[model samples]
Target: MPFLRENSGKFSPEKIGALIMVLFPLALLLIRALNGSFTPPTPFGAPPGLGAGPGLGAGPGLGGVDPALGARPLVEVIRFIGDWAIRLLLITLAVTPARRLFNWPKLLIARRTLGLGAALLVGIHFTFYLIDIGSLGMAAREIVLRIYLTIGFVALVIFAAMASTSWDGAVRRLGGERWKHLHALVYPATALGILHFFMQQKLDVTEPTLMAGLFVWLMGWRVMQRYGRGTGLANMLALAVAAGVLTALIEAGWYAVATGVDPTRVLAANLAFDYKISPAWWVAGSGAAVALASEIVLRLRPLPVRRAARA
Candidate 1:
């Protein structure tokens, strides 16, 4: 009670928003856990019906395939969670840069909560994936050996390590410089998560493309900050390099798909693309763009301050 009273002022609008952001994912997890047990509405924009399709529904007599064989409810839930987790991680990473550009101190409080929540979601995703793989009689070594799976595993490990040392006590123990260096691993973790998604999808790269765009924007802000204004030549060169790499990867992935090569077979096999656009993707893109824009506007506009009279 004393601690609560002492910290009552911390429950400001910004803090409340941060709390809501963290709770939203937790609510989704809870809904997923209770989905089949209580027949809840599809938790993660799962297209109206729960079981309806060739490889996603609960239809019986489909070549002796179990009704639940298509899209495991748990897997769908976990994927939805993973998607948000990555987005949240990106958002958390952007906060410091945003603060630097906008000169806002309030943004700092939200970062820790978002980072922790993202880590929790990633952990949930890993747990669900392992359980699903085990149920299919696949060995851990086999799962770990897959390119995308390995990437995802490494990303999750990095995220877990970062999350474990997120608190003030851990920061003090590790020292600020060491802590900062360790947390920078988040960038690579995010890239790996995006790669995992790109490899996991069977059809269309729309989602991955949008995610890449967001990451580009986030990283661009940092570059702009570091280089200062009017570094157009450097910016162009960086953009060209990024675009070239992305084009090559996209081409390679498409080639692999066309030839049935399955460069990331292990990771690809586990995914059942039911062929539907996820609303969450749009929502996330819109929200992030809006937030970034708002920060930009705030920076451009100055708040009025009262002046003391000389008389």
Candidate 2:
């Protein structure tokens, strides 16, 4: 209902659009699931990247199946839902930056919807994980012992708290300032989710690297905003480059340590696009696109001029 209603209790185009955006991913998941597209999952998660093509189990490194899932329909289902949860979380965090860039305050209407969607998906993701295990006791013990599971469970708890208190009554009880502080936990929760995602990867980490880069850009943009430089084109360009380089370094470091590959070769892979486009370039290209949009917005919708105070 909130997704369909504005704060004034009237249906607005913004809310309608937001509702569609919120449900589209779920709809895709349902369509795919019903079609038997979801198959067994990899040891880490699903496939290596989007380029690996559609469907749940349509990627390389499909050899290492999650023992818990063991060819269950829920194996790929868990990964699919979990990935979308992180996705919505990132999109929710992007709301503020996007609003400022395009001067579209209406975007705020969808922020909570996106966050709630993320919360729901993550809950489902965990529930599927439990169902796949087929034993509450074993699942509970795994959460306690496995570092990745522990981090993911903690992040889920934080998401639950945020979602529970997202209503008007909670806002009234907690007051605006305290509520703001409580919701700020989204950042750390996202970080932990990202860490859990990274640690779970078995072979290819294309999406994880991109996720990390975007997270880096998001944090850097916030820091720049604190210093009153967030909206500048030069600042954005710098942040973009920094984020991309960091992405490359993250991927290189992971390959070097995890697979015993040379870090320099990994870095060089970013330059050679013969096989793939690499996450670093994707991160940088995304930021550049944002910067270009901001420029167009600034020029086309320049702020109104103010006259001097009357004497």
Candidate 3:
């Protein structure tokens, strides 16, 4: 934290945010380790079935005798981290909108750090995936064979390029225009990442569906901003509501295609309070909350008063 507080540039709101971004994935890894996901006893890759050794039960560590070892799969941690990478990348994209929405100009400083943090997490996720598959060769083979992996790998490559050019020197060298063009790759990278998420999941695509919904909203907001129409609180709130509705429709469609479930049932489930809160509600709530906060803040800031002096 001391290092985090040290002067790098002008103090910006994103400074603290950048530090948190670094710590978040590390904390997740720590949690996974504490839950016994990292007690493999050996440095080698986990073979086909984890905890499948001759004497070991189907859990973490050798012989599965460690009390720390639970039934949770270590490979799931890879998915968790990968999901976080995608989320962080989305957050990075959201920074500009957030700054505009909240009138927090200093937030601009945090965007690059967030992008790089996402790239770093993605790199770690990919490393664990390679380890899980046993070797680089096998990983490469799988990527070639699997469309989802190919999509994810392409996104990673784009992130890598963006990360490499994130410095002042790169801006100076490439000129701002070219650099902006290159960084625009984040758009397609995000699409591919979301697609990869949808494809890789065998079941329970609620999370990916929410992510896609958020992505759609973010892009939609950008378009609105471009056309100079959606910068106000009311418009923003409307966008949020629309996005939530779109999220529900997307989820319903996916279930219809993948599971042969009645899309009407899925849509009706959004109206029902019989189940846990769905992602659509979460997305809508988040958007509305942000919009309300911005409205409140704008109202609270007092206008300068002019005094008339009496002779």
Candidate 4:
């Protein structure tokens, strides 16, 4: 197969890995469609299993159900898959910023594929969500009016616009500056997506918090790049601010977990005051502070000069 051919004259592990990463999800979907095993396989012959046996109808076998639950197993599975797909997309976007901080420039190549895959997964997720909503005999207007649905729709539209122009041809046509300007839409798209999740989630804000932190880190890098690493007093002040923010967020998160309250809901509902804090917020804030401190120290510390002798 042309795909299997190693044409780069180097080890093709990355090429092979990339292909497998792209195909594996689709392969799983195909298997699920054919076998009707929406959920992951359980322990061997475990009760309420997805095996091909008489117990299937009793809720353990393929398509087995009580019929009164109103929703199929397949539908639930699709929703779960879609949720995780968006989460993966957010993580993929973070990869670039993370790599840059670590000085790994080669990671840039994988960013486009990761982004496109995220868009594809989100598109599939929207399709499934729409299907499920329609199956309930609900009006399209009702679904659109939902906060989560509306935000999700906006996020998808942004992703679609970006994805359409992801190719080299589109980049050339738009010019690099214009293309980059357009791509900045990703920031809002991610924010909307996080909002959607924050609204839809029942209890934990862990995932949304992590995504928010990543966004902060990515954006902070840009700020640092713009401002020459601040002077001694400026750096101290910046680090102090970061430390205070981190401490507050950590304390709030701890309080929420202790009281069994949902931090996401608190933030979403009370936009005016009482900002929600999460572990991710702390991690991002503290990490950025430390990174900034390191950068400043490295820049200020004079390096030993090498002496050159002319004979």
Q: Give the candidate number with the greatest lDDT.
A: 2
**Model 3 error, position 222 (Å):** 1.0
Tell me the TM-score of each prediction against the true structure: 0.66, 0.86, 0.81, 0.60
| TM match of model 3 to true structure | 0.81
Which runs of model 2 end up more than 4 angstroms from their true locations? 1-3, 40-71, 304-311
| Residue-by-residue lDDT tens digits, candidate 3, 1-311 | 12234355445556677869867888978887787664322212223233222221222221233345442354556666787898898999899887766666667777777888889989998887776677677678777876777888999899899999988899999999999999999999999988887765534666777798889788878888777774667888998898899889888988798779999998888876665567788778877887788778656742223210110
Flag regions of model 4 displaced more than 4 Å: 1-75, 135-139, 228-278, 281-311
Q: Give each prediction's root-mean-square deviation over alpha carbons.
A: 8.9, 5.3, 8.5, 10.4
Q: Which ten residues in a row have the lowest lDDT in candidate 4?
A: 302-311
Q: List the residue pairs that clash in candidate 1.
A: 52-57
Q: lDDT of all the models against the reference? A: 0.59, 0.77, 0.73, 0.55
Q: How far out, in Å, is residue 137 in model 4?
A: 10
Return the clash pairs for model 3, or none. none
In candidate 1, position 13 carries an lDDT of 52
**TM-score of predicted model 4?**
0.60
Q: Per-residue lDDT for 227 in model 1?
A: 66
Tens digit of per-residue lDDT, candidate 4, span 105-213: 4455556666777788777877765565554435256445555666777888999999999988998999999999989898788878766755544234444455555
